[model samples]
Target: MKFKLIATFLLFATCVTAFSQEKQAQKSEKGLIKISIMYPFAEGKTFNMEYYETKHMPMVAGYLGSNLVKYTIEKGLAAGMPNQALPYMAIGTFYVKSLSDYQSAIAPNRDAIRADFANYTNVSPVILVSEVVK
Candidate 1:
């Protein structure tokens, strides 16, 4: 009976240690901060994809400096429903090391960035900050 009890306790301890290590590994594998800009589609709105890709994004990247890991711009194609309009016209995403770092880098450039909107689309962008977990 005592031998059985000892084996059971050892098994429990091993399981506990393995679970802890797995959790730690998952946490370490999580990715950096992701800042997403989603521009909802609306009628009578115009977007200059050329200017956005060629000029505005590069200027923004320059402002982000070392804080920015990478950035991507996605143009809206078609909606999931056939013949349905797209939910968003464009999406721009920025991967950064930290949320605070991104905020600090963008703070001073806010006005300048907003002012440059005239060079691109008139759509109001929705912003989302998230921790990438993949």
Candidate 2:
């Protein structure tokens, strides 16, 4: 009975690990990662849109080169429902061709990129990486 339990546990662990690896493989094979950088608003705090759009993004261009295929910027005006405040002050989507390209482009300039954040907004940004299926 003890041996059977140990075998079952091992099998479960192996399956879990395999599933996680499969997902990782799929993400890499897709060859596209959407890097989302978003800043949420706080009362009395302002988003320095001028600096972000004009300065920060341009600086990023120096590091990415051709790896960054495209990008989009969004300004939060209002929420869908009345009396609801906008969740984010702004959002920037960076479309990376591949995971390796994203890593190579970002690794060297990570510090400089993060340091520039203070120039634009007080709120710390949230970053999310995802691959699009559709």
Report lDDT per candidate.
0.88, 0.84
Displacement of the residue 91 alpha carbon in candidate 1, Å = 0.7
Q: Flag clash pairs in model 1.
A: none
| Per-residue lDDT of candidate 2, residues 1-134 (tens digit) | 99999999999999999999998867664656788998987897678889988999878866777877677789999888999988899998887777687888889899999899889888888889998673
* Residue-pair clash count for candidate 2: 0
Residue 24's lDDT within candidate 2 is 86
lDDT of 1 by residue, 9-53 (tens): 999999999999999866754788888888899899888888988
Q: Spell out the clash pairs found in candidate 2.
A: none
lDDT of 2 at 121: 80
Q: Which candidate gets the maximum TM-score versus the true structure?
A: 1
Candidate 1's C-alpha runs over 4 A off are 1-29
Q: How do all models score by TM-score?
A: 0.76, 0.72
